[model samples]
Target chain A: DAGITQSPRYKITETGRQVTLMCHQTWSHSYMFWYRQDLGHGLRLIYYSAAADITDKGEVPDGYVVSRSKTENFPLTLESATRSQTSVYFCASSEQGRETQYFGPGTRLLVL
Target chain B: DQQVKQNSPSLSVQEGRISILNCDYTNSMFDYFLWYKKYPAEGPTFLISISSIKDKNEDGRFTVFLNKSAKHLSLHIVPSQPGDSAVYFCAADRYNSGGYQKVTFGTGTKLQVIP
Candidate 1:
């Protein structure tokens, strides 16, 4: 219970519906990241937050929106889910930039 | 384009033998590199890492070798065991990537240890 945790480890949603993946870390790390893992693409960063109210887009952030209102939580929302959005989402946290990150179990989202 | 590349999709090695997993990078600005191992239903955990300044770094049975000139790196596991079977990802740190210190990861290589 001391490490990072993601809500709804498995999710099923219809296309065009909105889905939000929640990530909470108890460590209060300075940097939080969201990544999606897909076949042939590995893990691509979708968004990252340096601290509360500070967030930036990553490699593939077009279809996703992220917000960090609290230091302990960073949530990712898919405005209009599509089949291409079906992938495993991971949340990671680090104390500093370019440091070792601790990851959560991951949330598997399927868009039908 | 993929900044980090792991050409091998999977590899099988006999138990007690050495297992080699390789990675290549296209970016010359990467100053740090890391390897992560992941099992099904679990998040990836850091395995080992080496700085561009050093050619090698070792921890227990895991060792990471970085060749800055060739833009290549590798992870070698000695006495490979069945427990070592998992997906391994190589990551590179782009420190100057807009202050975020973005890490580009390879697709990953799955290693299987046959007894």
Candidate 2:
């Protein structure tokens, strides 16, 4: 509805396959972020976009790719998914500054 | 090297008691701190935040205390209820010289409020 939403709440894919997680925010926030949550490690930022066409890599960005062609949408793509990529993916959006963020329900991905 | 750390992996408290979750950070440049609560199969929602300049910030039953000298922050929930059971994550906002802002989150502490 009015908040952020992620597509395919649950996904199962094979290793080496490509998977893309979609994130859409209705609030029209200027900053969109992608984070992955694992067991020992907390939520690590994968990528963040300040505005349309402006993106930056976060802590763990080696295996992930992101693009923000539109302000309302930011998609994360895994070129070659591996078993280590299996984790809960979250999408968040915020205003100009990177202070408060609203998160989506999250997408659970299992790479077999 | 983890910048943010939540030493307590899990905490249990009886209902109507106080629940304390602690977080520590190694970066002194982090100016802002925030706490987020996440339920199973759901994204984390912002709970509360306190700037480095302030020692304490409170909202209703939730209060966040920041100790800048010790580089520690804590979230205290009074009169805990079952609904308060969730994973709480503490995040630090760091602004780099490049004019970019980044958030570093701790491993998270799972709190179970026994009702």
Candidate 3:
């Protein structure tokens, strides 16, 4: 509604399948980020976008792809989901040059 | 290779007591630090933050202390309440060659406040 949101709060997919997680922000923040939360790794960044057309890779980007066609939307896609990719994904947004981020409810994905 | 590390996986403190969460970083170039709180099935919300230029930053019931030399930071909550029980994450940020700042998060610490 007002803040940020992620679609398919929960999803289950088969291995080698393709899946996409959607993130939308109403604040129009310049920076949007995608992160995966795992057991030992609290939250590892997958990708981040500086603007509508500018995206960059983060620590863990090997299996993830992100695109920002519009300022309010940043979607993350898994070309071929694997079992190791199963985790809770969070989307965050912030103003340019600011480290403080606002996150979405997150999508819990399971790859079987 | 983890720049930010939160060694304590969990902590418990009695109501009305002070809850301290510590975090350490190995990167000497980190210029900013932040703390976030996340509840069950909820996203992390920004709690408090401090810059390398400042040693401490305080809010209502929360205060963040930073030690640049030791490469450590802490979040303290006074008069801990049950509502404060949640997973707290420590994050660090440093500007890279790119124009944007790259932020890294710690493993997080689950703080439980007993009522």
Candidate 4:
């Protein structure tokens, strides 16, 4: 519980279904981020939170939603999962702006 | 548009040789750069980082060189080891209005250090 962790390391779901990926960190970092990695797109930021109750969209945030109700937890949800959404999702946290981030083990999602 | 780009999809080098991975970025405003290494089933872990004010940074056997004019950077691992084989991603960063840094990552370059 000292490092960042992502729940449900692997998940399989059909298109149009909703799925949520959970992330928790014990470092109490003020900055948390969610990213998705694909074959040709290394790591695309989906969303980020600066602090509890303060979240903002990132480059690839069209189909995903995120919430940060607590400093230790940030969850991402796919409103309508699509085949294109199938990719490895990573959660990262940093102490402050411009600080190096520590990543979670990642969640491998498959949308059929 | 992809701001950070790693043109080489893969590279192979013999152990004890120098392994170099290149990256380029379109954005000139990026203030910081970082490299992340990822394994088959694990998420990426931070390897090295360089600030825009410096041209080079080194740690142990790893070194990162930055060229601001060319918007290019490279990571060099001397005497590469077989255990060093992994996918490398280059990322550019800048502090956003949200009081957090925003990162743009490259497609990644897979390096294979053969023994």
Candidate 5:
């Protein structure tokens, strides 16, 4: 109950449908990140927020959007999901950019 | 291109033997290295980390060694146990030219401790 958490541990959606993955952390870390893990690609950062309302893109950010209105919440949204977007998403948090990150349980999404 | 790489996709070792996992990075800017372990249906958890200034860092049965000159790092698990069977990831951290601190992870190596 004290660490980070992700909602909808498993999700199935149709292509072109909008879906959102929620991430919450009780640590109130300044840095929160969203990463997608796919076969052969490992974990690629989609977006990261340094603090409330300040976010940046990582290696892959297209088709995905993220926002951080509260320090404890960072939610990722897919305006129109595609089959290619099917993968496991992980949310991580750190006190600062240089600190060690703690990850959440992850959300598995299947876009058909 | 993959900046961080784990050449071995999987490793198997005897329960009582030592297990070694290797990782290589193409970026010299990476100053902090970390190792994470993950079990099925779970997020990866931090196991050990070492700063660029140190060649090695140890925590209980897990030890991480960094060879800055070679741009390589390794994780050694002594007296490996079945519980250690999981996916191990090697990650690197650095402040990029864009002024944002970034962390990159390797493809991951699945370690199996056979009894």
Candidate 6:
């Protein structure tokens, strides 16, 4: 597809384990972001990448790690997953500085 | 603190009626606002937006009104239809510390239309 896509639409992992959520965009956008959506918290930014190899923390980046080695891909890794990390993860891409973000289908992760 | 707030959790309206969804912001630094609609299992789609300079922006059945002084904005849908049933989100864009545009989104409001 030409738009952004997230791998493992649904995932189940145990606490203390490591998990990585993948995001790939075909538009070659310069900005890629990772957000987690929960019941009360709409969409809190976990991490954002301005360009390849340039990533920064977002609102809720405590337990999440993100890296962008290519313009088309931005993956989020949970070093040590916890129950608090169980939420729907969304990946989005924009042209440069947050003009408009196009989001992926989302990855539903459950921690046991 | 939540910069963007959507107080209504859900709203129900009859077809062909007016549907109004309101949003409030605590930060005056936000210069841009946008509304997005999302369905289950799908990503949110852009609905309408209004810049701080403009008070109102309309597109088809969707219209967005911005009140800078009150730090409030609203999305109004006229002659609402059943197809408009979905979750609507309000977002604000502010200049972050690093000079990048930062977006903060509201919890979202679910609208149900009865035909």
lDDT of 4 by residue, A60-98 (tens): 999999999999999999999999999999999999878
For model 3, residues B31-98, the per-residue Cα lDDT tens digits are 89999999999999999999999999999999999999999999999989999999999999998888
Angstrom error of the Cα, residue B33, model 1: value is: 0.2
TM-score of chain A in every predicted structure: 0.98, 0.97, 0.98, 0.98, 0.99, 0.98
- Worst lDDT window (10 residues) for model 1 chain A? A94-103
Candidate 3 lDDT, A1-112, residue by residue in tens: 7999999999999999999999999998999999999988999999999999999999999988999999999999999999999999999999886758999999999999
Model 4 TM-score on a 0 to 1 scale: 0.98
lDDT of 6 at B60: 95
TM of chain B vs. native, candidate 5: 0.97
- lDDT per residue (tens digit) for residues B1-115 in model 1: 9999999999999999999999999989889999999999999999998888899999999999998889999999998999999999999997654677688889999999999
What would the per-residue lDDT of candidate 5 be over residues B84-104, giving only the tens digit for each residue?
A: 999999999999766667899
Itemize residue pairs with steric clashes in candidate 6: none
What value does the lDDT take at residue B39 in candidate 1? 95
Clashing pairs in 4: none
The segments of candidate 1 whose C-alpha lies over 4 angstroms from its true place after superposition are none
Which candidate number has the best lDDT? Answer: 3
Residue range A1-112, candidate 1, lDDT tens digits: 8999998899999999999999999988999999999989888989988889999888999989999999999999999999999999999999999798888999999999
DockQ by candidate, in order:
0.83, 0.84, 0.92, 0.87, 0.82, 0.76
The TM-score obtained for chain B of candidate 2 when compared with the true chain B: 0.98
DockQ of 1: 0.83
Pick by DockQ: 1 or 3, better one? 3
